[model samples]
Target: MPGPDLKRILARATSDDDVALSETYVWDLASLFSYSPSASQAFALSFTRRFGRTKSWRVAVKCLHLLHRLLRTLPSDHPFHSHLLRSHANAIISLNPCHFRCTSDELTIFVRSYALFLDEALFCLQVTKDPSLPPPETFAKKVEEVDQAVELVSQLQGLLDRAMDCRPLATAGRSSIVRSAMKHIIRDSFMWYATLWPRLMLVLDNLFQMPHRLCIAGLDIYTSAAEQAGRLEEYYDWCKRMSLCGPYEYPLVEKIPQIQVRAMESLVENMWQLTDSSSSSSPVTFSSSPSTLTVSESGSSNCVETLKNAAINVEWEKFEEEEKPLIQFGQECADWEDLLEASVDCSWTWAPLIFDEPKERSQNNGDNGLRKHEANLQEYNPFLDHAHPHAM
Candidate 1:
């Protein structure tokens, strides 16, 4: 297709005498966009670059309107759509409102174009069932599309900075663009596309540090999530590491102590099961009082019959079962935190623990004259507090 009409029109439009009027060139360029899958950037670029340079504000408005009209016929799958849209936007925006004489109305062209592109990018994201699990090509394409929209939004943020500096009226639109772009960045990185914990942490780290108004809302939600999951302690620790540590408005409320206590109680209750099985195999030896019992080992016999203390008794096999999993989990965690309420038992910092029980004090045996056991809930737990830095 030799496009004789296009060539003839361009020849006339470019003639030295006709340089002042670009209206004919603008309308013809919009028409050129309708040419199907083979639309070339050269014509669209020429239209935007040439017509947008009109010295008259009214003529610039006309050129902007022409670009808008061209937007209507943009085929859904236009091969050059992004390039065309971006070029058109830059051309109008380069007419930077205040000093260069390009009016605020030209900005409307960019706003509309960007809104369309961003909306389409969001639509594509909706189809991706799992962003992390998407096929490689599909994933890359979707991410690239999102990145492009985010980049455009960044431009809007810069525009807002300028608008605030000189043109207050342009501030609202540019602020809106910044907010919209920030939302997309958050949604794509944390809400929809986040597949790994580190990535989610990264988003939180950025949000916690950003002074933008949007970040306040983001942090509010983030704090609520951490509170719900009982990881506020660890979460804020990372926040500090990223230099994004903010005032932790939420109080650290933990149900972990209660949960841990309940688990220990359950293990104690279940201890009888193992004891019952072991009783037949291992003979029990008793003394007048466990405190007076002495271990008289004649050889390296690996068996130690229970020397039951007058106050407390422990099932060794059952305690091992209950603590082993916690020990393994802690060792695997690689966490150096002094206190992680959620997984405190999984801390590997503790020394090799063989046995643990609360100590007891007998107060003259009272009137009964028999020994009594008083277990201190907090002051005398014998287990090593590997999870607490102060304990170490």
Candidate 2:
């Protein structure tokens, strides 16, 4: 049984009015019960967490959608939204921890992470619309972060899904929330594809490559093997690969016309934005109120360390590396690194499991960029490879 103090903590965290604080409190509660499985189970089933995860999945689903909603409300220059993303990413990743030898059933976590990656991309697009973000050049760097995440996701899908008949998110099949999430993913993905493609083309050279050009699943637009395939065919093929992407069915044959019009319209609108960029002398501006975690203050290192080691905590630096590019897009974006320099702030902690290959080889058949990444990682870089004494 929980004491009065525990009840107080739980009450504060579950409040919808103060969501940012809820992150910290829930994390605290999660850690408090980790060592006590009975307590953890009991607490999880307390009609709150259990219902959030099982009966309705709204709370667990909020783990994705609510964050997206919150991010959409924030200005791109606001530092806290990114922090929330990192924290949310870490929490989601922890839910699906994977060891190399783990069975196929354990791949759910990996799949969830992939869906989150797309969510992050959507958030970036939403925020970057703020005139305050950096220039397009720096914005282009965000593509790398997305690509890297995809590489990791593809690896998980490939090796595990190879031998198993796992329906992408079969673990949560009973939950309608997952189904709704899939629809959101498709809607947002088309928006993302529509928005980013023109921006990349205008600033980047033709010689430069985007892992799959405009495709998120690394589907090859030009494949010798599928000589008869056209744009619609290519789109449907890539959509098929993102099968576990969310809880929805693949938007295929029956849905082709609807998707075609949406995607084409989105592309045209982005093209207009691209043309408008050069002519605009002023861009609209906005800002977000800071959250407690991103308030640019520090507590005791011991307390910080405990939080860092807590299952919910993520590394500040690695997350910074991944997120810096998104904020880098325009000249007016916020300075995240300087604002939270005192502490690592927060890092996007990923699952420990690393895959040697994507769930399935891409139509490109070049291993996308993972092979080169693996090779480059083998070479030591004093800057990136070394741990900071402060972090230690």
Candidate 3:
């Protein structure tokens, strides 16, 4: 059980009136418990209420901070753990053109935070011990809830799609909101795909192994919803804009194109093979291959080959393009190679923790006792340091 001091800190942390609690208080409260079902529920409710009422970008940021902190203390089996998870799923549903106040910065924060939360939750659930505590049935229920949320997101996305297809709205904020909302929807969709891809693949594998065929119409709900919402073109435009933003920018920009290319290639190959096998024994055969057959076969092969060649060409062209001289441009237009390099290198300095072994166990038994003692001493040292600056 946590001490009374911890309860006090948590009360202050969750209070709407004091949004600027100290970082130390936040960290201490988070470390006190391995999991807290009630705390998780309280945090979710507070975040939803605050976020719903505020148009402030700061509110979104604060909500994200609180969410991240709450999630840090929640284990998958905790009663209210799913509540926080569902809140995120619900966010996608609620991020509609009507509900979302679309500032670029705010939308970016929301999408990023949403993605991070889902990623962290999935990771914790997948990697934690005692996975049976949540049970498969409970997980299935959670997934169904997520599915409903996805439907809502698709509906919201459709609105943005319609707005983008039509002429710009007469109102000042309306068109901008629609465009920004569209970006957010596309981003959310991509994040959904990223988060669900592994689980979907596992389901597909199970279906392939089972005696009975799997009916996956429910899986296509997102697609149908997007089509109904009128956002297919908007989705495409969003992807195009993301690609044009840079050559190799953003966390998963490279991944999106790669996944699409691989999926398209696989579909084309499978269809072509099926067609070829069917045509080989057909009664009616033309001297040339059927037009549909030829188009499908040739188009698939040609497109893939062309794309591969283009990738090689682009690599060579990048070097040449970087060397070309240009007329004097403003400071804002200056090349940021140095800045980019510095940032990338800085990331590498922490590679041990980020890229090293995912888990490690301490081998020194002697050190464990010492570590415990040190922790106890540190815990009480805060009080001892009240009268001495150096003691702190």
Best by lDDT: 3
Question: On residues 216-288, what C-alpha lDDT tens digit does candidate 2 reach at each position?
Answer: 2333211211222244345445445655344354333222223323332332232223443433322212121
lDDT by residue for model 1 (1-392), tens: 52555555554554433124345564675566556334445555455554545554333333433343344334445555665656546553233332324446544444333333332332232222333454235433533433333333333333322222221133422343323322222223222222323222333323212222323333333333333334434433433443332344223423223333233233223322443343232212223322333222221121112212211333433455566342344355545463354366564534796774334433434534332223343345555354464963
What overall lDDT goes with each candidate model? 0.37, 0.38, 0.41
TM-score of each: 0.25, 0.28, 0.30
Model 1: how far is 188 from its true place, Å? 19
- Residue 177 in model 2: shift from native, Å? 1.2
Candidate 2: which stretches are off by over 4 Å? 1-59, 85-111, 114-174, 203-392
Candidate 3: where is the Cα deviation over 4 Å?
1-26, 31-37, 40-56, 83-392
Q: Which has the better TM-score: candidate 1, or candidate 3? A: 3
Ranking by TM-score: 3, 2, 1
Query: What is the TM-score (0 to 1) of candidate 1?
Result: 0.25
lDDT of 2 at 105: 41
Which pairs in model 3 have colliding backbones? Answer: 158-229
Worst 10 residues of 2 by lDDT: 288-297
CA displacement after TM-score superposition, residue 11 of candidate 3 (Å): 7.9
- lDDT score, residue 154, model 2? 38
Residue 150 error, candidate 1, Å: 8.8
